[model samples]
Target: MEIEVVVPGGATIGEAPTWVAAEAALYWIDIKRPALYRLDPATGAQRSWPMPSDIGAFALTADPPGAVVALRTGLFRLDFASDKLDRLAPPPFDPKLFRFNEGACDINGRFWIGVMFDPLTEASPPLKSSMHSFTLAGGLRPEPDAAELHNGMAWSADNEIFYLSHSQRQAIFAYEFDPAAGRLGAPRLFASVPKDDGLPDGAAIDDLGGYWCALHGGGRLRRYKPSGAVDCDIALPVSQPTMCAFGGADLEDLYVTSASDQLMPEQRRREPLAGALLKLRPGVSGLARSYLVR
Candidate 1:
């Protein structure tokens, strides 16, 4: 599988790219700058939206013509057509202690979002952040357990398994997922990379049921089997590859997003493509795109 560069030169921290099949567009977020972008491959057209606060996660709703965003305060709706933003949930308790990070849509159209530990409260022991799931049923619940820095999240093809990452810890976890009940089982350590290796950020599942994850600081994207074995490694030009997803009509074009926000001056100088988006052509196709609950 050969990897190519796409949107080749700009992104501070690109994460969570969702494919909107109907419109043939890819929607992704840049957490550092807190902006949203829609890229149309056909015309190479890219449009961006500024967020009042950092966006942790968001997804395109299946019924409605907009996406749901998990913001610093709470959840809200972003109407792409009208370019309007509306609040969906009130600010959570301890609003200042947490902010949104990674988000994705599940098989049931629920949006799962992660929160980053507040930097202001460093003296406090590292708190275990939770992965929150929003259902069309209209309620928010912590899926199962808490993570130090919950990042990438995705479900298996049958929707029975879930994968999550703790970025700073350099580990990924797997759990049995029950979509109907919106519940998860106890997590077992999935895999961990050495400190010198890149940290796992965002990931997506392919049609073959394998998961492909971008190693944020590691400069590569790695694929894994359900058993947690490394199947393949695809290197990238950037060191901060944040997320990757399969888009394009055939679902074979692998689009990856990277970042530059936390790079040291020296590292940035060495890797000018640090924040650029990348594209790869893999041997396997990806699963169909999931939609968010309206």
Candidate 2:
């Protein structure tokens, strides 16, 4: 597989690459820069919307034809055409202590979001964080488990399993998912990275049940089988790859987002593609992304 640079500029913390099949465009966020970006690969035209606060994740919505965004302040609905934002719900915890991080929509159209302690602003951040499920009618519902830093959030093609990563722990976990009930069973260790390999950041599930995960400090993307075995690993040009998603017409193109935040000047120079958006043909098709039901 050959990797190519799609977007060349550096983003502070590029993450949550979501492909909109309807528009044949890609949407992603720069967390620290606190902006939402949309890119049209065909035309090479990109657009951005300034966010009021740090944005963790967002899911395309079908009903209102916009996006449901998870920002540090709370969950909000953003009108893509008008650039209007309407608050959906407030953050479950105090925003000062915790902020939303990773999220995605399930097959049922319920948005699942993860919260993490903000170490950048808080002098002494706590290790505890939580995940929540949101719907237009049901609102936000917190999960029973906790983690240090929640990153990867995805569901199996069958919707019978959910995958998440605890970056601080360098582990990715799998849980039996009750999609009908929107509940999670006890987590089982799905995969782990050695200290030198780097922390598992964000991930996506392919149609064949392969979990493609981005290794932050390791500068690689690893595909893990559903049985928790490694199948393939691809080296990346940037050291801090934040997330990956499957796009392109057939959902065969893998787009990886990287981060340059908090890197020393010399370190940034060494990793020239540190915050670039990269694309590669992974030779596998991905499942269609579920949109928010609201």
Candidate 3:
């Protein structure tokens, strides 16, 4: 399938891409640029907002005027209009060694976020990351099992299955999910990406039970069967397709985000579209995003 550039405005590290049905716009973050954007898909009208600190992840909240965001400092609620931030939770770990990364809202209206190792200089020591969940009533709490590079996150349509990926581990894990309570059981290895397939960064689940993942360094997107088999693979022009989400009117259009942060000068020159917002029709609709209940 062919993918066209949706919003040509280049991003440094385009990470989380999500659809807003009411606004008819796509929202995503450029981690390297350390900013947020709202793109009108049909009109190509783009609006960018700079963040006060390094923003790792964000999700549209149940409240129309705000969004829950994970920043290097901690979790905060941003008023999109006023650009004011209300600190909801402080960083659980020391900011010197860790920073927030991937995040998504669960079926129960809770936001699940993950953190990654961030060293000041080049270090060869083994590093690990952690995950957490947040709700206005419950506050922020940790998730079980520290990860090497916590990345992909998704829940099944039936709300009984959960998917998580650790980039350094090169494997995606599956767990029994309790949607009513937003809890996860013991996990088992569901599938592992081959060396040639690239590391998994972010992912989403379709209504048909297919898991769509962006291959960070391999420049591809893959749809995996619920049984842990590779069902479909689509190539992209960029070498580092970071994350993807299902958007558009019917949620059948797949939107992909890429990265140019790790690209060398030559690679950047070769792949001019490295950090672009891409779109395609995957022929399968996706489940609507779960709102973060205040």
Q: Which candidate is the best by lDDT?
A: 2
Q: Candidate 2: which stretches are off by over 4 Å?
A: 120-122
- Native-structure RMSD, model 2: 1.4
* Candidate 1 per-residue lDDT over residues 95-128, each given as its tens digit: 6677878877777777778877765445577677
Candidate 2 residue 67 Cα shift, in angstroms, is 1.3
What's the C-alpha lDDT at position 205 in model 3? Answer: 89
Residue 270 accuracy (lDDT) in model 1: 87
- For candidate 1, what is the lDDT? 0.80
- C-alpha lDDT of candidate 2 relative to the true structure: 0.87
Cα misplacement distance, residue 39 of candidate 2 (Å): 1.1
Model 3, residue 243: distance off in Å is: 1.1
Model 2: colliding residue pairs: none
Summarize candidate 3's per-residue lDDT along 1-294 as a digit string, tens digits: 888998663688898997888888899998867888889988889887788777888877656577888888888888878888889899987777788888888877788888788755676575776689888889998888587578888988888888999888899999898887888898999899987889988998899899999999999999999998999899898889988889888998999999888678898888999888999988999988774554
Off by over 4 Å in 1: 120-125
Window of ten residues with lowest summed lDDT in model 1: 118-127
List, residue by residue over 189-285, the lDDT tens digit for candidate 2.
9988788988899998899999999998889999999898999999988999989999999999999999998789999889888889999988899
| Position 253, candidate 2: lDDT | 93
Q: What is the TM-score of each candidate against the true structure?
A: 0.93, 0.96, 0.96
